[model samples]
Target chain A: MSPRRGTRRLRLSDPHRRVRFGLAVVLTVLTIIGGRLVQLQGLDGMKYAAAAEELRLTRLDLPAARGQILDRDGNALAYSVEARAIFADPGMIVAPGRTALALAPLLATSADALMGELTADGRFVYLARGLDPAGAQAIMDLQLAGIGELVEQRREYPAEWTAAQVVGFVGQDDTGLAGIEDQYDDVLTGTPGQLVYEQGRFGLPIPAATHSLEEAVPGSDVQLTLDQDLQFTLEQALAVANENAGVSSAQAVVLDVATGQVLAMGGSPGYNAADPGGVRGDQLANPTVSHVIEPGSVNKMITFAGALEEGLITPETELTVPDNIAVSDIVINDAWGHAPIHFTATGILGKSSNVGTVMLAQQLGNARLEEYLRRFGLGTATGIELPAESNGILLPHEEWSGSQAGTIPFGQGVSMTVLQMASMFQAVANDGVLVPPRIVDQVIGPDGTVIDQPGSEPRRVLEPDTSADLRYMLESVTNEGGTAPLARIDGYRVAGKTGTAQRPNPECRCYAGGGYWATFAGFAPADDPRYVIAISVEQPGGSGGGGVIAAPVFTSIMSFALGDNGVAPTGTPSPEFRLTTDED
Target chain B: MSALPAYDRPQRVAGRRTEPTRVSLQRPVAAPAPAGRAPFVALILFVIGAGLIALLVLNTAIAADSFTERSLSQQIEQLRLQEQELQQEIGAAQAPAALARAAVEQGMVPAGPPGFLIVHPDGTTQVVGEAKPATRPPPPARRN
Candidate 1:
């Protein structure tokens, strides 16, 4: 090629050179893409996938509702109500001063305080907690972007004062503060759920995308074993007794003899469950289980049982009742003002002869009497599944002496809780089955599952025949001319004993009239015992004995309870005996 | 050179130019303008990814809130059960039935007002009264 031609060869830089350069650049880009692809697809894929998953799924604990407590007929004694809590996001409050001003009046708080809270740099703060749905809605209507609401649960007692002592109340944190609430809290609470969501830098949710959702679980409902009508009757009767007897307080308890289930348990000066602050500290304690009182002549039932079980006496056994019997230095007397007269063993009970009881106790001796008392569940707690039960004051064998025996036979020198007393009578009423008393029926789980079944054990305490004999004799106490005539119910045969225990004087070591515990314990429809009721009026001024104060109260409560429970009348006549056969 | 008239310098192959235009000159030459559809298409994909993430977050938040609410509700319920049990205990403790039972266990026997046959100065035992009078008629009011 000529130089001129080479020089002048407007070597049109090959036009395809630009194409080749673009190709080179494309090739370089492809290499980079391949390398980056290997890094992401081969190595970072798992990491990024994990990050994506982290944003998608959230695990949540689902909380369940506590159990509902219901009556035997499935009436709601206590239940839960839904409420809402109001909160705020300080950052979102567009105008802190204005928001506070708007919320102050509705929140029932000072505007300045609300402003301080809103203006605080905190991300979140509670403006109001535990507000009802309506209150929450009112706050929401303010349309303050910073405001938030959360739904919660609060407790509600329907029959506010009906079963106040039995239903208990809760604290602000929903913890069981007192009563059944404290005992069954674990069974009523449930697990909660958590949620995980992929959030953007601003934390706002992206619309219409797949996300993990964990639905919350609800708690369980509980059912109780209380009878509302019976409870009401018992409370009213106790109030009346307290008023008429001039007693500081009175209490009544009704139980199903066979089942040991407490049907009605109440006392005078009862506290309301919704507001428990009004209850006095002393009254707050369940006096029946914790307070110890010396049972008066009612203890004679034990003496009579001892005498009958030993075959030492029958209803026809004869004894002479003097106006008074001298036992060493002490003189014992009869409540009935009878002259030295002929009487039978049953007559002794009817007349409530302290000397006769002492004679019976002397025959049994301290060892046998103590053994019987122990067998009857004295000197020990009933273990009734309640908090703070007292074992009652049972004099040790060392404390027992010949003189103590005579005195104890007439109901003195010992103390017992009301529960222990009721349980003992329940034993007799149940035809000798001394089943452990039960307050809680069953514990239910949050998911409506039965968690635990309580009170399934039944213990045979006395022979059926012995119990029947005792019942027959007890009925006479409420008959004409008997000490507790007022205890008799018109349409039903009732068997009961009255106790007018003199409160011992700490100074004189003797009982005084100023402090008397008039007590009545019995079972109704005597032939077929369905309910056993016990009542006592403490320090009933001038009422003197169980017949005057306690027996009438028992009659009132027992009749109402029997009728409320639809108990059929006992068709069989109460067993009777004639004491005229006693030899003089 | 005839000024390379119509086919000058082989017309620079019709695609080749001696220099780029001023408007094109100011344009970044490091890389060609991205395809009109690619970046926008990539942006759409990013938006979809973002939306999915947002949905996941929202669902997670809702689930968590529900769980919290349920847990609080359960707490409230348990508290209620405890309250009921306690209340029942209080009732039982205060029940007169229990009190009476306690009396019986303590060997207590009910005592009624004692009846009396008051003996007068005539040396005869006769029933003087059904109920006792603690204070007599105060000597006929002292005949004031």
Candidate 2:
């Protein structure tokens, strides 16, 4: 090549152009990087940071323990225990069959079901809930690839069937499904908490990292007025009575007469709270407060109360009573046929004379009879702390037919629950003050604060003088000539009424072939009553009377109640009654 | 080293008095002559090295403590579970049915209506309820 000498320099490599080229390329890359940084850090900084945080954060739910349902004496009827819910990630599993085989024993789930769950699931599947934490730990020790556990709570019923109808049962999610559990669900379920923190790979919290927690507040406990011992006895007696009477079902309730608190309330064939799956739907309810039946001669007490309260009759007042009386297309007869006789007001009740009771009702009339019924808290809810209560069937006095007026006085046409019957006796037992039965004593907070729950306000239904006269008259029912001699506890001044009402047949809409509701309600040491117990058994297609079937059950339970509570029997003897005003 | 410092002090005075002589810190003897800050530098480096070692030890201890805390909490959880299990067993055993079954297994008979004996402060005794001898066994045996 020829060289130009005078041009100052020959172009060997063009160093200036090369330097410009390198600068242009470097500037282009720098501009792109700067723009991207601006986009990320300045333009959408909050959104991108939040997204990254979301990917790095893990949230755990801390479940606060549900409250315990304790009996009046501080024994747990139902409580919550720590447990775990086992789950699996199907995608992470190596072999579904092998995993199922390894987990079946620990989970107590069939391998076929586990295999189905593992093979047919998407990403996540719950294998079992409410597994004991120790068992869950054992499963985790197996180191199955996809299995994990979560915190949960399981309901434990220590008393089991003893207070099942009163305490109720909890379902899969630990929600109360029946009884007190259902009634006090809100008070039993506590607040849940959340823990959110930054997590590293494998979802473990980084040490000393920032985290936030909202403390969980536990639920308040419900202290029931149920005496565990008395309740157990009540249920046992009902079952025995049911077996003896060959009845369909039976119910009984014991109440503290002074405080209107339910010491025990239950029924036969009670479903065990621990295993509610095998129980029938019909037996799950607290039938003592819910089921309504004609009270028969027990309603005669109200009739007697009406007559005595209105000054129409005294305990010794004599009247001419016949064997049967016709009233509006029906003839009502006494339990036994007899000629006309002179009878006292006490005689009518002690004898459970249907004709004599009708005679008393005729004197008081329907309006006054209805007044006494309403005052006794019949035909309405007893307001006990139970669900599905009935305000028993009662037509108004104005709506009563002539036959109804005759039958209602003896508790045939009118219907009431065993609880209502007890409250009637309770009114007499509590010196004429009616205290609506209460099943809850207090609500205890988690932090040891006690909130006292006052029961329904007491109302005076009858005069104290009338109640005294009524108690004296009822004392004769357990006497020699009276109906319920079996109900008498030795050395105790027992008083009660017997009921043998004919159940209305659904097929025929009449009392025929429907059997009877044998019921006996009473209170012991009748002078100053402390407790009132109402016992009833439904004998379908049976002929037993209340004094025979229900009185035995009553005696056993009442004996226990009186003895268990250390109630002293009066040393005085029961007074004599002039059942018939006869000239010997 | 003491004689060297004395000899360098004279040179330092001569340097100030005659003309500005360039000082070289690489010369160890001359470095301490004018600045006298070598101990301060050594002290700072010593502090930094000691701090680094202290941090390492502290970190290791904290890591160990965290591990201990984890294991202890796990043990406490296990103990709590064991206590719960025992309590559950006791509760189940305390149930009326279980107690009745156990009593039956021991050949115990159900007492008839319980009777009370009152011992007055004066030492007089009187029975309240009618104390009857148990004529029948427990309900289960009777049923059989």
Candidate 3:
């Protein structure tokens, strides 16, 4: 069919019409796109950009390094070392048994244990913690697919067994477990930080992406008042005493009499701090602050001091004493059998006469005796900066049994720690002032600012004159015929007491046979005491006398301590004291 | 009208004479003044392009520095670890047991009772308690 007239005329006969229509369509589309572009790019750009950046950002936690424990001379007793912990993504690990076998030797773990950890139903699991750098690096070099490493701090005690009880140890999670570590945990642990940055698709950080870091703050360093040299000496002495006396355990503590700082404190059979896993739980406790034993004749010093303070007796007061005194169905005797004799207070203490001491305690009575015991820091924790300290056992005057008055006077019914016993003598050595023993001396902050730990204030327990008289009387105990003549240090006037008390049987609440606590508490240069040493030997196998077993240990430790610290001896001669009375 | 003189009539070309031969009157239109060179706009565009290129280079440099910074940080961490390890070694060496063992290996023994030299205010020095040397010498050197 022929085309219609209008269609033939309109259809492409004029090319300009087609071009004009195309231009108009192109312009209309461009106008629509330009309007939308203005709305998006100029008005809503920031929000979209922020959302895009947010999807790419990641936050990482930064761990802080734990603090170090230093000795008085800046020796690192305990410190945190950098280490790596190995962890596994159990779901990602293939052949858990094979992987465990491969990692066993490097991790120092058994294959079965590692396999158990690996086959556990969890996304993430720790295979090993606190591995050394070399060991962790070796495992990392294995290129195990699911294994990864995290940097962590491992606590280390370089001195090993030296002062182990005081420095303590940390657990696998870097938490303090005992000793000063547990006591000062908050101060030792630092604040962790955060790292915020953009990461790419494969979890790698995007280069030039926004990054913000809040740096981790390291913990402060704690300085203890312990002198490591003296600590070594004390430990050695205790070890030797234990071996020589065939005792179950031995303990010794040396304190700076003036400052009440624990210069050295230790017990034999100490556990290694680095390898605490195999140690007994009881061995981990610091026995110097925890173990309580009857103070024996050492408690007589308190009785005499109480008597002297109350003006009930003088160093020259004469008394007619018998070999044994019977009081309320119990008979107390001197450590050695002696006749009824005239004795002065000094002679009584020198001889360690239980009869003489009970006579003096009878004059002071139970009320005054209990008050003096409490005043000397008994029946309460000394508030030292150590964990698991015992308050010791000091029964009230009303709680005493009929025979307790007699036995307690001679130190049978009372008990105290070696540290408390040392502190008691410290009061006498420090001129009638009782200063609480302190282990920590200073804490240095991360920014190099030092905070000195103020020691506990001294409390007056006795008059200066009373302490002087006590010192004079105690010196006679180490004199020529005194009970602890072996405790005498040549060229120095020594003042101390000897104590030998039978150990109480746990099964039956009575004194056990052939088990005695031999103890000696004293200070050297008696005229001007510098250091106080207290030594206790438990259950000396043969002749368990404090004078025979504990006194020599004190002499050795005191001599070394004085010599090491360069304390000069007092040149004045010790005054003469009569052990045998003229009326006898 | 009357017949005009042939000399005064306008001249026409041959082909258009068939339709009404219209005389075309034309006035000379001045050509537009040559457009001034827009060098300022060109210079601005050039500056913008150059700035974009400079920014691209600077951004690449910063990215490269970030990688370098990461590498340096890693190296610093390694050095810190090494420092701690060396400190651990020193601490081990200085431990009392190690020192005592070393001293024993070197023909030395623990000190005996230490004597003191007292310096009097009057310039007289007195030695108290004779300082005895440790009689036990170190064990004979190991042959192996």
Highest TM-score model number: 2
Question: Ranking under DockQ, best-scoring first?
Answer: 2, 3, 1
- Displacement of residue B135 (Cα, Å) in model 1 is 40
Give lDDT tens digits, candidate 2, residues B1-144. Answer: 233355435555555554354443323233233465567656767888899999999977876776777689889988999999999999888877777777788988666665678889999987776767767566642111
Tens digits of lDDT, candidate 1, A293-328: 888888888888888888878777887667777664
Q: Is candidate 2 or candidate 3 better by DockQ?
A: 2
Clashing pairs in 3: none
Instruction: Give the residue spans of candidate 2 off by over 4 A.
Output: A1-28, A47-56, A198-205, B1-35, B117-127, B141-144
Better of 1 and 3 by TM-score: 3
Give lDDT tens digits, candidate 2, residues A1-584: 23565333444257897788789999999999999999999999989989988888888888998999999998889998999898999999999899999988877779998888898758898998888888888998999998888899999998888989989998989888889899889988999998898886755566677688987788889999999888887887887877764598889989899998899988887888998887788888888888998888988999999999999999999988999999999999999989988988898899889999999899999999999999999888988777788998888999999899999999988988889988899999998999999999999999989987766989999999999999999999999789999999877899999999999888898878888999889998899898899988898877788999989899888888887888767667789888998753
Instruction: Supply the TM-score of chain A against the true chain A for every candidate structure.
Output: 0.81, 0.94, 0.89
Chain B structural similarity as TM-score, candidate 2 = 0.68
What would the TM-scores of all predictions be? 0.69, 0.90, 0.86
Higher-ranked by DockQ: 1 or 2? 2
Better of 1 and 2 by TM-score: 2
True contacts kept of each: 0.00, 0.43, 0.52
